[model samples]
Structure formats: structure tokens, C-alpha cells
Target chain A: MTEFIPPGTRFHALPSPFPCKRGGALHGARVAYETWGALDADAGNAILIVTGLSPDAHAAANEANPAPGWWEAMIGPGKPIDTDRWFVVCVNSLGSCKGSTGPASINPASGELYRLDFPELSIEDGARAAVDVVRALGVEQLACVIGNSMGGMTALAVLLLHPGIARSHINISGSAQALPFSIAIRSLQREAIRLDPRWNGGHYDNEAYPESGMRMARKLGVITYRSALEWDGRFGRVRLDSDQADDDPFGLEFQVESYLEGHARRFVRFFDPNCYLYLSRSMDWFDLAEYGDGDVLAGLASIRVDKALAIGANTDILFPVQQQQQVADGLRAGGADARFIGLESPQGHDAFLVDFERFGPAVRGFLDEL
Target chain B: MTEFIPPGTRFHALPSPFPCKRGGALHGARVAYETWGALDADAGNAILIVTGLSPDAHAAANEANPAPGWWEAMIGPGKPIDTDRWFVVCVNSLGSCKGSTGPASINPASGELYRLDFPELSIEDGARAAVDVVRALGVEQLACVIGNSMGGMTALAVLLLHPGIARSHINISGSAQALPFSIAIRSLQREAIRLDPRWNGGHYDNEAYPESGMRMARKLGVITYRSALEWDGRFGRVRLDSDQADDDPFGLEFQVESYLEGHARRFVRFFDPNCYLYLSRSMDWFDLAEYGDGDVLAGLASIRVDKALAIGANTDILFPVQQQQQVADGLRAGGADARFIGLESPQGHDAFLVDFERFGPAVRGFLDEL
Candidate 1:
């Protein structure tokens, strides 16, 4: 029997043969998730929150920890998400490393880590996994569903693949299809991990982590997540204090180098290299039009949600504001009351995470209306 | 006794003990150079051209190799540079591998490849080496000095360090100093090279090249050199035909991936990783403010050139058009005849090389006036 743990919650296993989008099946797969507030008697007040590539399921704070969550500022009683009014469910992505069913998880048949043997994943798979968790909890219909970055793509997939799962939707910093520039960037990142000698063809021992490759890949990712405009204003051309006895040309001289290093180092502590490889590829392969017989508007039409909100950062090159506008336009054309909000930000694709002041109010307004 | 090669000719060595900007000098250092057209009476019509990080001394087609040069379409008889009217000389930058004294060159003292032992190079060192070559050829004064990308930075340094060597300057797609974003990108690239176990601290045998690392770095470089606008227009979300028997997430699915792979492969065939490291760092270390004791305008004032031209591409994120405008403004404020021209392009930082039609006209107009 699954224990009903309070907020800062633990995970529960999904039934066997979890269907994946591409082909292979996941046996006895599980999803790690967290929750806040109480589910209504009718089980109609649940809000499912999906996350980006790196964030965990800890989207909001709980009484057990009380220290604050990743989105604590905007997810409290009076905040945009309003935990007092709505039961928020945040799921750790299926292909992620945070206690989720991923390449790092043990395979039931072989009794060993799946590694590269893990089924090829897609955004649709992630969305379906979240829906499975929701249904397992005896929820007939969700009040709303929200997603950011990778989550945004998954949320759209969930609505398209399983219609009427939620009454409303919120997609943030995501695209209808992966742009070539983004695909190229992610491809280089995978190459960085795979080229590392220690990767060992995805069979590396736990002790022999692909540290250098993972760090390099994370560094590149950080560069893309944020904007050059922000870096210029923050670090500029200022030199950092160094300990080198002689001038090392390749040494960390600029403050920006130090900033990138700090971020990359922090990421390597939690993220798995193989999981990064798999999840990044899944995001690159995502295309909403695939579900509608190569017609994006048709796919949008398939989403039966009553309302939708599409939020974008003007400076986001990964998922440009234009793509977000397309999401809003597509949904509106498909008979859903959709609203698009383009926020001016120097934070680029990361603005949704960093600029909660502007984001929170917009989200609150959208949710209150629903 | 030096060989007197004709116009459209081959290389000649710069004298030994090539003086560098910071501390120790390069021993037995030599520069490879190519020329077009005849040096006129009094040698007053010579034009010096400096290239970017990758290009060699072969800026235009010559008698030796009838095949066109990298900039052949823009540097011939009736082209922007007009070889028939002015003697044009293109030198391989110091610390570059193409027929120049670089990490790939043998060290006179150790009798082995200099590799990392190659002294930390600076843009000023590149300028000085080019000046030495010009002096060796009996040229008293250059009619103009032209630089593109890395060359542009070197051209500025030449004017600041050796004020009266050239009468005019054309700075294209280059910056007065490295921006934070660029520094971060370059730092990650260097990490990619260092992280490769095959690099062996720059001591790897020729046969055991760090091919994967170099290819990864080049791929990242290619992505940054071009813009997302161009990639979106060219490749979009079209999938390339793949031979994978089963669904592989890491498969080459996008045409953009193929394009990047092709470019990376071609670059790895010619570029030395160590040389790339040195030159990339040299660019990061460059700052015009240092020349004038921390005053950029003061440094610009030190350039005793008759006139200057600063051309920037609209889509260039590496060295932005705003930075180029600053260059023009600084020169004009410093009592020099300076003009700034912003060209619309989807090619980004590479516009100077790829969109020669737009670039050629601007350069020709600037040179014709001078």
C-alpha cells in the first residue's frame, strides 16, 4: 500500500508496462512527486505542475521543511499558485534523476541499472506518466495543469494525447517544435558527454562519473539558458583575482568565467550525465504537429482544455516570444480562450524562474479567471 | 639572403626573437604571408590585411594555387580591395598554426613542438609580428591596414602600439575588448579541450589527436559564429534521413546537426587544438582600455591614423553593433575621422566572411575615400 505522506512527499510506483511514446515499454516504472494543500472531497481542485530539465519535484515548501521551495515565492497561500485554494502536484520528470524512473533506475528483469537500455523517451511519455500518477490518486478531472520549459512541452503533449485530463493549461518558455538552433546546442552538449572517456558508452561505474564532460555540458547549458545582455551588465570585462604563478592564457580571467564555473559545478552535483543525454534528446525530438498528422493547428485543436495561458520572455532565444505567440494563436484558433503574455527580461529563457514578481501576477490573474 | 617572390606569391619569414607584448619573446619566430599586386615606387601603396581566428595568409587567389582564396570574391583586380591599384599583404596571425610560429611549431631550445610552452600570446604580439614582416620587405609606410574579426582587434593594436605604421584602418566584425558572453563561450571551449584525456597536456602524439574534443569545440564555435535567424530559415524542423535500425534519441535527426558536423570535421582537419586555445585566449585578454591606462577614449586618441571605418553586422551577438558604434564614437571623439556603418545580415559575426557583396561595397567605399 502507498503511504499518504504529507507535503515534501515521497514517490509511488506506477503499474507495470508503462507505455512509452516511441516504442519500448517501461516495466514497473515509478514517478517521484511532491504535493501541497489538501485534495477536495470531489478531487476536482488538483493542479499539476511540470518542471524544466534541471528542477526537481520540489516546487513549493511544506510544513516539514518550511525552508521554501524552488517556486516558494509564488506558490504559497496568497501567492499566484495559492496552495490554500488549490492542491498543487509537482512531478519529477520520468526521465530525470531525482528519484524518478530514468536511466539510473534499476531494471526489474536484469536486476541492474538500465543505463542506455532505458526506452527512448519523448515529451508525450512524460505527460502520460504525470497523467498516470494523477489517475492513480483517484482524480477524475484536474482543475489546471502548468508547465515550464520541458514541462511546458510535456503539458501540451498531455492535453493533446489525453484530452479532457485538465480544465485549463499554462505553458511557459516552450515551443510547438524544437528550433534548429536549440537542437544544435543540445546536440553539442550530448557530444560533450559522449566524447568523455569516462562515459564508457553509458556503462560507467558509479564511482567513475563523467565529471569533466558533465561539467562542460552544464557550462554550455548555462550559457544558453541566460542572455549575453545579462552577463554584460553583471560581469562585463572585469578581471578576477587569480592564483596562477605565471600568466596562463587559458586560466579563468573574467568574472563571467567564474560565474559559469559556479553554475556548472552546482549542476554536476545533482544531475546524471546519461539522464541529461536522454532528456535533452527527448526535448529536441518534440513536435506538436506530429500528433495532428503534420498539422500544428490540428494538434492544438485536439487539446480540449477550456482555457490556456502562454507566457514567454522577449529575450528567450531557446523558445522565442514568437513561438509562445504561436501557441496562444493556435489555441485561440482551436476554440480555447487563450492569452499570451510576453515579458521583457534580460534573463532570457530563465526569466520564468528568476522574475517571479512579474510572472506570479500574470499566472495569478490567469488562474483566478479559471 | 631572402627569396624575392612576386605578387600573388608565397610566404617569407619574419626575423628571429619576435618581440611580444607581455614579458618573454618568441624565439626563432616566423610569420607566413601572401601578397597580391606590385609594391609601387616609394612603397607607399602597400595595404596590410589581417585575418580572423581561422583563415590563413591566403586571403585571395594567387599564381601558386589558381584555386580561389577564402576571400577571393572580394579581393581581386576589380574587387573591393582592388589588387591592381594597391599592393595587398595578408599575414597569418602569430600563435596561428597555418605556416606561422605557433604551438605546432618546433621550439628552438627544446627541439620539440612548443605546444603549451608557446608563450601566452596577445593581439599586440600579432600586430608586432606583422609590422616586422613589413619592415623586412623594405616598406616605409602602409597606405591602409585592414582587419576582420581577430584581425580587426590586431589592426587596432597595431595603431595603438605602433601609431604611424599605417595611414588608415578598417575594423570589421571585431571588438575593442572581449565581452562577458564571449569570454564564457571561449572558456567552455578551452575546458572541452583540456577535459579530453587524449589531449595529454598538449603532449599527445600526432597520431593520437584529441579529435572528438576538437570536433566538439569547433561545433560550438560554428553555432556561435552564425545566427539562429539564418539556421531557422535554412534548416527549420525538417528531419534528415537516418539509418538507425531502431529509434535512437542521439541519432543525427536534424539537418542543422549535419551542417555543424560537416563544419566541425573540416575545421579539425586543419586547425591545431593548442593553437586554437592560444588564439582564443589572446582575444579574451585583449582590451583597448589597457593601452590608455584604463581610458578607452584615450587609447583611441593614441591611434594616429588619418581615417578609420567600423563596420558591424546587425545580427552579430559576439561583437554587437552597439560595441561597433562605440568604436566609431571613441575614434571620432579622440580627434580621428571615423565612420560607423551597420549592415543588415542574418549571418551574424560571420557576415564579414559570408556576405561579401554587402561587405565588399562598404569596404571598397571606405578604401576609395582613403
Candidate 2:
């Protein structure tokens, strides 16, 4: 798996004994990444795009695969962060189940799946891995680093830990730390997976997977990602008319139930349950204030970035707009040129994914300034 | 079970062949009820109190058990809905496990647990049963009927389906119909119960209960019942210090996680999983407009009540204040004296349970006018 890098993707091994934040070390740890466009001679035109929880390295379509990537709309030839003008590199997170080495990875020493033996992950660790990938590409510094959700926290981690590596940082719908509401939501998601008897202490037989738990967790994720207003607009009280009035009342009788079930079923097939558990825990444990010596402002003020942008959605409940405003305030107090933009969309925490028209201009203008 | 009627509690069998809204009939359906105070000479001083998804008929401390009930703060000698001046009747919902004939009950014909064989339930069915209990107490008409959450929906159903049974109705955090957002949430809750392997298609062995699923469902419910603002104020980012730093990253590490776990564990002991599934589906399918041929205003117009109160919490996300305003508007359009009052509190959908100071006076005032 490590020897043959795909045409559009590359793999790089981190330095020996990469120390994880939660007191674990990995040997021969590798990162999978994809790049679009060309790097300048100075290598300063590179733009690193960090992803949220589930996205992989395939950020956009390429000659090798015509299938659109997760951020296909925003990373094309003529889109925001246009490939024609900048070299865009997207790396799969360290504890992700995609091409990256995560909980599903094999332990070199034991010749078994890491599974629960995998080190506890944190946003800082993901940030460190991304920086290693950037350095391996012979890029001394990045022109900008863009992050969405979990990626947003990782970008902030990069600014605090490896300052001066990225001249500009864009944090979208991420917070300084996980709030109680977000923590509670994630706690239930993990419990759903752990409580499944099929899980068997994270060593379940592959044939009988914990699909039920994963599906339930994904259903919850999809619900929280969008606002109630968005659900009302997309699917009102319309019943699933296929079921007659005589059908079981507990069956999926609403259109929203079918919609949630459809998405959750698809998610269970591709995502690894253990990776989800690990990554979600990592997000909850990440506290930028911990790095800043117990003060949120001190932690944010410690960032040495030159320019930054904090974007939030007005209807986002997961990471409310108030947190985004705090990010901009902290960045400004830290002496960085930071601009705050709040998008008015019912898309909620998912505004960045669907509201490209509003987000595209903001990214384009910010990049133009740099 | 019917032989012993606790001091203040009684059981009333509904009229033979009780017809359910969703095309089903119960041959010997019974509702358990508790009453506070005595009826007047004319037998008109009755206040029927309907309950939320949980909670039993024990709404307040009575002669038998001195222990304060769920709403002990707001219902007593001189509290709101004062027992000294008016008769108060509290009934367990039609599909509940607390003394009411529900899924856990043995079918008269089958001689076994009704389980999934129980008829589908609706707000109208619960409302009709409560009215029957009130009539069994020899009260021809009720002075007021008050409901909270699902109980709120039942209150509306009482107004629409059985007009003139109550002269006044108080709806707290209830909507005319379930929204897609709420439907989606309830669907997931039911899925949690049914997906559990122990559920065994709603026929699990009595010894091996589907506690995990029920616990997970209750955890989700407790989280949604409160607001993010309230969670932030109550739990914040406090870590579970009981666990060492080396504790499993996936373990319950936040104060909110512990709180939810404690509540969920207690809930699993008292609430039956199948009853939870059936009632949640009922709430999702209930539509007041369906009672009036799909016209919400017409449904409200069908109510013969003289006065109404629609109460909502400002921070409630499940049933927003906007929906309560619509309730007031629809009732007013029907020529009823309806008042819409939005309580300012972080309690969210559960404000009625805790904000007695704010909710108490409103209920008292509404009944006084009637």
C-alpha cells in the first residue's frame, strides 16, 4: 500500500518516533495527500486545505479520476483557490479511515490492526502530521492554510505550534475548544458504537460489523450538521405516503426519516467505526486554551500568523456564530489582520459545504489581499 | 394490578371497544389517574393535567405518598392550579407503562404482553382517555386542561376532538403538528430501541432488557430537552476529574457526559423501551389539522373552548416559541380568548418543569379568567 503512490496522490513517512499529544509514539507513520496545479520555484504559492472529520485526500477531481471530490465545487480550475493560480494540497487527517494511517492501520510490531491500541489523537497531532507532509514536499512555507470544522481547529493548532509556516489561516465553523453541547452530542455518538455487542471491545469479527451503531451515529451527525430551519424547508411534515394508514406506526412514515436512513446507510459502508470513535474523542479533547496556559485569549494571542479569516454560519448550533466572533477577536488581539464574516444561511454548520456562492467570494477576496 | 387503588389514585376502564385513531380498538382499555382536592357541589371545578413523554399520574404530593411529585413545585395547596380551590386530575397517557394499559400490558384476548401487538397510539387517544377519567370522577365539565410537551399536544387534541369537555386549555411548548426536525429526532429515538439486538423485535426476554438502547435514547432526549446555553452554564468544559489523565479517551470525560449518563440510567429502570417506541411514533404522526381535514385554522375553529393559553420557552429548539404564537393566533381566529406567553429562560423545552415562578402565575391567571 505504501510503495505504489497513485498518479494524483503521494505518500510520505514521518520522521522516526513521531510523538502524539496523548502520550503515544508511532514508527514509520505515513500520510496520504493529493495536490492540484503546480508549485512555484519559491514554493510559497502552496495552499494547504485541511478537511473536516470524514473527508479524504481526494478534495477535487483530477485527470486520474473524474469523480467529484468532497470539495469539488470550491477547488476546481476556476473556483475559489483556483488551481491555475495556486498549488493546492489536501491531506487526509492522521486518525482518519481513508487513505491515512489510522485506527484501521496495521501495527508493524504486532502485525495486527491497531484498533483500540491506536494512540489517542488530537487536533494538534493532525496539524503536526499535515506540516510534516508539507515539509516532505520540499515546500519551506505555505502561502495559506484553509480548514473547515475539525480542520479549522487543526489550522489553529498549526498557527500556535508551528508558527510562521503558514502566512495566512482561515478557520471556518471551528472553535477554540469543544463546548458542552458539542461534547454531549459526540459522547452519545461514541456510546452508540461502544454499546453494540458486535463491537466486542473494538475487536469484532469483520463479517458481523457494528453497522447498526454506526448507522445510528451517522444519523445523529446528519441531523446536527444542518439547522432545524433547513430541515423544515427541505422536508416538512410530508408523510411517506407509500405506507398505508394500516402499516406499523413505528415504521419510517416521514420523508425526513427516509432521508436520514438513506444517508446513514451509505456512510456505514465506507467509514470505519473505530476511526470515528477515535477522531470524535480527539475533537472533544482539543482545547487551544490548554496550549495557551489555561486562558483562551492567551492561547489565541500566541498565534504568530500575519493574516487570518474566521467565517461562521448564523444558524450553526454545533459551533455557534458567537464562537467565530471570538476567534476573530482573539486573532485581532494577537496583532493579526483578521476579518470576521457571518453567512446567513439555514445550512447551519454545513454552510461551508453548500453555500459556495457566499463562501467563494470571501475566500477569493482574502487570498487576493495576501 | 387493578385490585389495589392507592389512596389518591383510581383506575377507570374506558367504554368497551375503545377506538384508536389509527384504525385499532382496545376491548378493555383502562387509564390510571390521581386526583387532588374535591369537586364542587355543581361538579364543575375540575382541572385535568396531562403529562409529557415521561412522568406518571403522580403529579404532586398527595395523602398516600408524601414524596413531592414531578411538578411538586407548581402544584400544591396554594400553588398554581391550587388544589385548595379547584379539583386537579392527573392521568397516565394511554400508551404509557405507569399503571395505564400499554405495550407492557397483557392483551385480554392473547393472555400475553401486547408488545408490538398493541394498537398504535395518538394524542387524540390519550386526550380521550383523560376525558374519560375526568367523567368517571363525576365531573361533567372541566374548568381547565393543562399539558406540557406531548401532554401539550394532547391538550390541543382534547380541544379539537372532544370539544366542551374542558372550558379552557393550556398548551405548553406544543405545536399544531410535528415538524420534520422533531420527526427526525423521534425517528432516531425509536430506531435506537428497535435496533438493539436485545429488543428481539419488541419481544425481548424479561430478564435481558434492551437497557442499552433505552439508555442511549434517553441520553439523546435529555440533551435536546435543554438548550446549548443552559448546558454551557451548567457543565461548561469541566473534565471528569475522577478519571485519570490516562483514562480511555472514549470514556465519559466531561461533566455533561456524566450528567446524561446518570439521568439515562435512572430512566431505563422506570420507562419501558417498547412503550417509548410506540409513544414517540405517536407524537410524530399526530397532526391537529388532520382532525379538521388538514386545515389548521379550521381545526382550531372546531374547538368550543372559551379561553386558551399557549406557553413557550424562549430557548426551546424542539418546539419553538414561534409555533406557540401560531397556536395562539389559530385559537384567537376561532374566537377563543387565547393568550401567547413566551417565558424567558434557558430551560428550553423543559422550562415548564423548572420555571415555576414564570409558568406558575401564567397558569393561575389563565384559570382565574375562566
Indicate the worst ten consecutive residues by lDDT in candidate 2 chain A: A1-10
Q: Model 1: per-residue lDDT, tens digit, A1-370?
A: 0111235556868778987878899998888888888899999899999999977787777865576678888787988999889988889999888867888888897998888889999888889899888887878688998999989899998888777899999999987878898999999999888877888789776588788888888998889889988988999888887662226556677788888878987877578788889899999989888867897766676678889999988888788888888888888877889989999888999998888877888999998987
In the order shown, the candidates' DockQ scores are 0.84, 0.87
- Report how far off residue A14 is in candidate 2 (Å): 1.1
Q: Chain B, candidate 2: TM?
A: 0.95
In terms of docking quality, how is candidate 1 classified? high
| C-alpha TM-score for every candidate | 0.94, 0.96
Question: Candidate 2 lDDT, tens digit per residue, A1-370?
Answer: 1122234666779877889987988877888898888999999899998889998888888776667888888887888888998999999999887777888888787898888898888888899999999988888789999999988888899778897998988888988888999999988999999888877778865687888888889999988998999988889887667843225546777789888988998888678888899889988988878867887877888888889999988999888988888888888889999889999978999999998888888888898888
Backbone clash pairs for candidate 1 read none
- Deviation in angstroms for A72 in model 2? 1.0
Model 1: how far is B268 from its true place, Å? 1.2
TM-score of chain A of each: 0.95, 0.96
Off by over 4 Å in 1: A1-7, A243-249, B1-9, B243-249
The local lDDT score (0 to 100) that residue B266 gets in candidate 1 is 86
Write one digit per residue (lDDT tens) for candidate 2, span B1-370: 1122234556899997999988889989899888888889998899999989888888888886677788998788888888888999999898888878888888998998888898888888998998888888898888988889999888888877776788888999888888888888888888898888888788876587888888889988987899999998999898777743226557778889889988997887678888888788888877777756887666776777888899989999888888888888888888889889999989899889998889899888887776
Candidate number achieving the greatest DockQ relative to the actual structure: 2
